[model samples]
Target: MKLINKKNKKYIQVFQLFTEEEWTKSAKNYNKNISSFFSGKKYEIFIHTNEETVTYLIGLGKSTMQNFEIQQVAVKFSQIQKEKIQAVPTLVLADFLKEKQFEEFVKGLLLGTYSYPFDKKHSIWNPKFEIHFENLSQKKLDAIGTKSEALVNGQTACQEWLNKPANLKKPDILSSYLKNLAKKYDLKYTVFNRKKCEELGLGAYLSVNQGSAYDAAFTIIEYKTTVKNAKTFGLVGKCVLFDTGGISLKDHNNMHYMKSDMGGATAVIGTLIYAAEMQIPVNIIAILPITDNAISERAFLPSDVITAYNGKTIEVLNTDAEAG
Candidate 1:
C-alpha cells in the first residue's frame, strides 16, 4: 500500500471523464459487488488471520459530516478493538465529484482509526485497519492524504481531550490544558472568571452555566501576526462543553448526544492549533465559552431575555436553544 499524492493526477483526470449518471451507476454497482462478497458471511475469524477481517461500508451521510459524531463513532469502534477485532476494513461511500464529501470521507476514516484501546485485560488492542474509498481518484487520494494528515492530528487531539470523563476534564483541568498549549504556542489567552462574566454583562452565557458545580470559563485566545495591527478573523464558538439543557432539562436519550454540543468549540480550537503550527500568516481570535447547561433551580428558563456581547437581546423561544 503506497500513499498516493498529487503526482498521480491521471487517476483524478479519469474520474472527471464520467458523467453524474455514470458515476452514480458505477458507485451503486461497486456497492452491490462488495455487498455480494460479504453475502454468505463466509469470512471467519481465528486467532491470527487478516483474511477473516471483512469490509464494512459506512455512509458519509447525505448531509455534511459532523466532527463530533465522527469522534463518537471512533470512540465506539475503539471498544470493538477491546474485543480483539483487529485489522477491520472500512469503505466510505462518496461522490468523487464533490470535493468536500471526499475530504470528509477520508477524515472520518482517520477518526474511526483513533478509537483503539490502549489497555486490555491481558493484551492491548492497538488499531490496525485498511481503509478503502470508492469513486476517489488517485489524485484525489493524494490530495486527501496531504490534507488529512493535519486534520487527523487535530481530530486526535480533540478526541483525547473529550474522551476523559467529565470528572477528569472539568473546567479547571480544561483551562490548564489550554494555558499550557497557549504558552507552548506563544499565544495570548484571557480566561473570564465568574466575576468577570458578571461584570462583562454576559448574562446569557452565565445563566446557562449557573448550575455547573465547576467554574465556567470564557477562553479568549489570540494568535498574533508579525505585521502590527494585522486584521484578525474572530471565531466565536458556542462552548457549553456539556449541556444538560439546564432547569428545562433534556431527556436521557437526548443527553447522550449533548456531549457533542461543545463540538463547535472543539473544532475552532483544533483549527487554531493547526493554523499556528503551520505558521499561517494571519491573526486569529478564538472565543470559546465553555459551560454546562444542567437542570437546576439556578438554570435559566424560557421567556428570559438575555443580552449577548454585541448587545443583541435574544428572547428564549426554546429553553433548549438558550446560549450565553
Candidate 2:
C-alpha cells in the first residue's frame, strides 16, 4: 500500500460530505448534480467520469461522524471499486473531524481492502492503492500513518491466526507463536506445559485437555510500563484451538469453522502486539488457556463430578459445555 501526500493531484479525488448542501458544494467542481446522480445517503457512493478525470463522492448521512460509520463507508467503497482504484485523494469536508477521525478513516480503508486467501495459489483482489489526505498538517499525517499501519498489521495477524486450519494451529503451535512474539516485542511471557499445569493445580484448564492427543498450554503475556502506580489490566482468553463437542458431538455440517473457537485468544494477542508497538503507558497481563475438546476414552463424561483448580467439585451436565 502506497501512502502519498496531496501533491499528486492527478489521482482520483474522493470526497466525504455530511449533508446534501455539503455534497452539492463539493461536487460543483466536477460539474455534477448530487441528487440527480445519487442519493446523499450515508456510505452511498456516486462515481462521476469526465474526459479529464474520475471522482467519487460519498455521503456521511448525518453531521456527526462515528468510527464504525467511517469503516462501513470505506468497506462499501472498497467493495465497489476493488483493485481498479489505484490512487485516491480523500477530501475531508467536516472541519470537526480531528486526528482520531483521520486515523479511523485510514484504518477503515486498510481493513476494507484486506482479503485473506488462505492456502490459495493466488488472491482475487490484492489492492495496492495509494491513499492521499488533503488539508492535514505534517504531524497529523504522520500520526495517522503510524496508527493506521499498526492497527491494520495487528488485525491482519489476528485474522491469519483465526483462519489457520485446526491441524496446523493446535495448542503447542499457538504457544510457540506467542513465545516468539513476546521475544520479538521484548514482553515477558510464561508458557505452562501439561506437567507445569498439573504441578500448579490448573485442574480446570487441564480438565478440558484430557481428551486431546495434544498437550494443553497455559500462556501468560505481560507488558509493563515505566509509569508509577499504573493501573493493571488483566485479560483472559479462551484458547480452544478446535472444539469438536467432545462426547456430545456436533453435526459434521459447518464444523470446520470450529477452528475459530480460539478467536478470544487471537484478539488478546493482537491487542498486546498493538499496545507494544505503540508503547502504551499501561501494564497488561494476558492469560490464554489453550486446549482442544476431542472425543476419546479419557474424555470427561456427562454426569461426572470433577474438582476444579479452586478445589470445587462440579457435575458436568454436557461435555459440549466445556467453555463454561
Candidate 3:
C-alpha cells in the first residue's frame, strides 16, 4: 500500500491509531455500545461498520513508544487489516506526530506490503494507502513517503539476500552484487580477493574461507558523506555465505537454514544503502569477511592454529567455532 496525494476520495475503511491514554479519555465520552466492544489495550483492534465506510480502531498501549515500537504498531495495523480491507485504506494516525515518528509510521505502513522472498517468484504490493493526518502538508507527506519507501526497499533487499538458498548465494554472486551496489551509489568499494587477503595477513578469516572450493574475499565498503566533520562508524558483519561447520560438522536436521549465516552482512548492506540514499551525514566503513565454511580437501582441521589480521594467533579448538 502507498500514500496518495489526492484527497477527498472515498475509502473502503478508515484505520485509526490510538494510544492507551487517548483511547481512555475518548472512550469515556462514547456510547456504552461502542465502549463495550473495544478497549484501548496494546494491539487491540475493533472494526465498526458506519453508514457506508468501515472504521478500524487500532490501539498502541502507551502514548510514548520507542521509535521501533511506533513502526511496529503501524506494521501490525497494516498486516491485520490486509485480510479485511483492500485498496485505498485511509489510516488516521493517533496524532500529528513529529517528523521522525511520522516518517517511521509511514515506513512501517509501506513495509506491510512487503512479501516474503522466493526464488523465481514475485508478488506485487498494490492498493494505494492514504494518510488522514490533519496538519501534514502534501509536499511533506510526499517527502516522508519517498524516504520511508527507500528504507523499506532496502530492508526487503536484505531479506531477499538472506533468504536465498546457498547455491544461489555463492561467493562470486554475492560479491558481484556488493560491487554493483557500491557502483550504483558511487561509494568506494574495495574487495580483497584470496591473494590479497593472504597478503593482508588475514589468516584467521582465510582459514575459515579455506573450507569451500568457491573463491573468497575480504570486502570493505565505505560510504563518505560531504557533511562537514561527519563521524565515521566502523562496522563488521559476518559474511559466511553458508556455514557447514567445517570439520566440526553440524547436525543435518536444520542445515538448510545455514543460508542465512550471512545475516549480519546482509543487514549492513541494507543499512548502508539506505544511509547513502538519504545522505544521512555519516561515514560508514563496513567490513564483510566473506566465505562459506563447507567441507572440502582444504578445510581447516579442528585444532589448527592461525594468525589473525591484527597479528593475534588463534587455535581452532573446534572448527565449528570459526565465527562463534
Candidate 4:
C-alpha cells in the first residue's frame, strides 16, 4: 500500500497507451512500431518482454478519460494479471497525465482490487501493493495517495454493507452500526425509535415498516469540522434494509438482491465516514429512514392514505413502490 517516486528502484512498469504518437514515444527503447502489438483499443493489454524486465502496455481508447472508466480498466488489468502481480513495487509511467488524471488513476488502481465473497469461506489474498509514479512530484503524489485511500476505504465500506444479507442487516442493526460508527469517529448521532417516529409524524416512513417484525429506525449523524464558516450539507438516505414488495409481492426471481435496497443509506453513511476520516472542512448531516417492506395483515393497503412528515397526504397505489 505504499506510494513512492523513485526512478532508480526496480519495479513493474505500466504504460498507458492512448494514441500512435504516445505509443511511438513509449516503444522507442523496444525498437517496435505501434502496430506491432497494439492499436490503442481501450482496455487492450500488451505484454512486452525485454532482456531485463517485462512491461505492461494498456490502451486508453479515448483521449479524455473518466474516473469510472479508469477504475474499470484498472480492474480488468489487475484481474488479468492477478497471478503475475505480487505485492511488489510498481511504476506507472503517467507523464502525459495531469494531476487530476493521475489522482484518478491511482484511485482506480486501488479500487480495482476490491472483491466481495459474502459469508462463504475463501482464501484471503494479501492486498498490499506499492505504486510508484515516475513523472509526478512527491508532494502531489502524496496528496493523491491520501485522497485515493479515503475514497477507496469509503467505497469498500459501502460495498460491504450493500452486499450484506437482509437477515443480518435489519433496520435496528443498521442503526446501531451507524451509532457505533458515529461514536468511533466522534460524530454526533441520534436514533428515533418507533414511538419517537410516531411523535415526529414520520407516517410515510413508518408505514413501510408496519408489516415487518422489526421497528423502523430514524437515524441522524452529523460531522462538524473546525473550519470557520463551513457550509452545511444535509443528506437523506432511503434505508430499506429489505424490500419484499410489501403486500404487492415481488417475483421470486432475483428478489434476493433486495438486500441492496439500502444502497442509498450506505452511500450516505460512507460519504459521512469519508468526510470525517479526512477531516474535510465542511459540516455534514445525514438522515437515514431505516425500514423493511414485507407482507402481513398490518401492512398498509394499496388504497390506504398516509400522512408524511411534511403533512402531505399520499394515497398508496402499490406497496411495492414503498421504497420509492
For residues 69-157, write the lDDT of model 4, one tens digit per residue.
66677667765676676565566775677777667666766666667742211111243556677677788878887888788778878
318 Cα displacement, candidate 3 (Å) = 1.3
lDDT for each residue of candidate 3 in 154-194, tens digit (9 for 90 to 100): 78788889878788889999889989999999899998888
Q: List the residue pairs that clash in candidate 2.
A: none
Q: After superposition, how far is residue 265 of candidate 2 from its true place, in Å?
A: 0.9
Top candidate by lDDT: 3
Q: Candidate 3: what lDDT? A: 0.77
Rate residue 39 of model 1 by lDDT. 26
lDDT (tens digit, per residue) of candidate 1 on 16-109: 1122333345445444554333221111111211343332323222234344444343334334443443343333333433655456534543
In order of lDDT, best first, we have 3, 4, 2, 1
Candidates ranked, most accurate by TM-score first? 4, 2, 3, 1
> 1-324, model 2: which lDDT tens digit per residue?
444446554544544444455665555555555568665567777776667556566666665656778667766766566645644343444554566665666677667665664321111123334555556776677777777767776887789889888888877788888889999999999888889989888876777788989887788999998888988999998788988888878779978989998899889988898888888889999999889988888888877777788888878777773533
lDDT of 1 at 263: 70
Pick the TM-score winner: 4
Q: TM-score for each prediction?
A: 0.58, 0.85, 0.85, 0.88
All candidates' lDDT scores? 0.58, 0.72, 0.77, 0.76
After superposing candidate 3 on the true structure, give the runs of residues whose Cα lies further than 4 Å from its correct spot: 1-10, 28-31, 64-67, 89-93, 96-100, 118-127, 138-140, 321-324
User: Which residue pairs does candidate 3 place in steric collision?
Assistant: 2-129
In candidate 2, which residue ranges exceed 4 Å CA deviation?
Answer: 1-21, 25-29, 32-34, 87-97, 118-130, 321-324
Question: In model 2, how large is the Cα lDDT of residue 276?
Answer: 86
Residue 278 in candidate 1, Cα distance off native in Å = 1.4
